[model samples]
Target: MTPKHVQINKQIKLHFALLFVSCILATYLSGPSLSSMPLLQWLLTGLFFAGISVLPLLFFIPTVMAPNARNLSWLGFFLLAYLVWGVVKIFSPNGLIGGLLVCTFILTTFFYTVIWLRPLKKAAKARQQLEQD
Candidate 1:
């Protein structure tokens, strides 16, 4: 890869990390954290909600930390559930803001992930053609 590609990859990874953090924040926002609850209850509720939503994504930590085309593609596919959840939950009476935020974060992550993978995919295809030739 050229220096330009290396630099772009670093930037893409940084943006993707930021998107992931924002998505997690959206999830936490969806829970009862904003309600007028006591300190302990609020803490537990926030933690449980965040934990359940984030636990599955934790499996992709390796992929996020060191991205490759295949793993990044898989991660994109995995995020579809979050996307759908956001869209569906938007209609709920109490979750409007949180749902909108979730939709925003998930869509940003998905599209950015695709952008990040495009160059890597082209490079992989080039290598495959070289091997065949």
Candidate 2:
């Protein structure tokens, strides 16, 4: 892979990690803004909120590092779930900077995935057609 390809691969990983962290932050950071909850309580609340919501991403670590069009497509679909969560969080009570942050990261990640996948897919399609000749 070229340097640019490698850069985007690393970025996809970073984005997922950020999304995971933002899920926790959306809960932990917002609660303090609305209430006088103690640090530990808010922390646990954040952990519980993030538990099942974004954990599936852990399964994609290896695939994302060496992404192919097919695997990236699968991950793209998975990111929709996060987009929904981010949108919901946008208007939900705890929604605040975290909601926006989550949405921002998700979009950036998806954009990069698409940019990476497009050429690979086109090349694959071209190669398949040539093989048929």
Please name the candidate that would achieve the greatest lDDT relative to the true structure. Answer: 2
State residue 103's C-alpha deviation in candidate 2, in Å: 0.6
Model 2, global lDDT: 0.80
Per-residue accuracy of model 2 over 1-133 as CA lDDT, tens digit each: 8899888888888887787788777766655543566777766776776776667877777777778877889889988877898888888786868799889888988988998897888998999999999
- How would you encode candidate 1's per-residue C-alpha lDDT over 11-115 as one tens digit per residue? 656655655565566555665645588888877777777677677777887877777788888989988877787777677655677678777767776776787
Per-prediction backbone clash count: 0, 0
lDDT at 99, model 1? 76
Note the Cα lDDT for every prediction shown: 0.72, 0.80
As a whole number from 0 to 100, the lDDT of residue 95 in candidate 1 is 69
Which candidate has the top score in TM-score?
2
The residue-level lDDT of candidate 1 at 54 comes to: 70
Residue 64 lDDT (model 1): 71
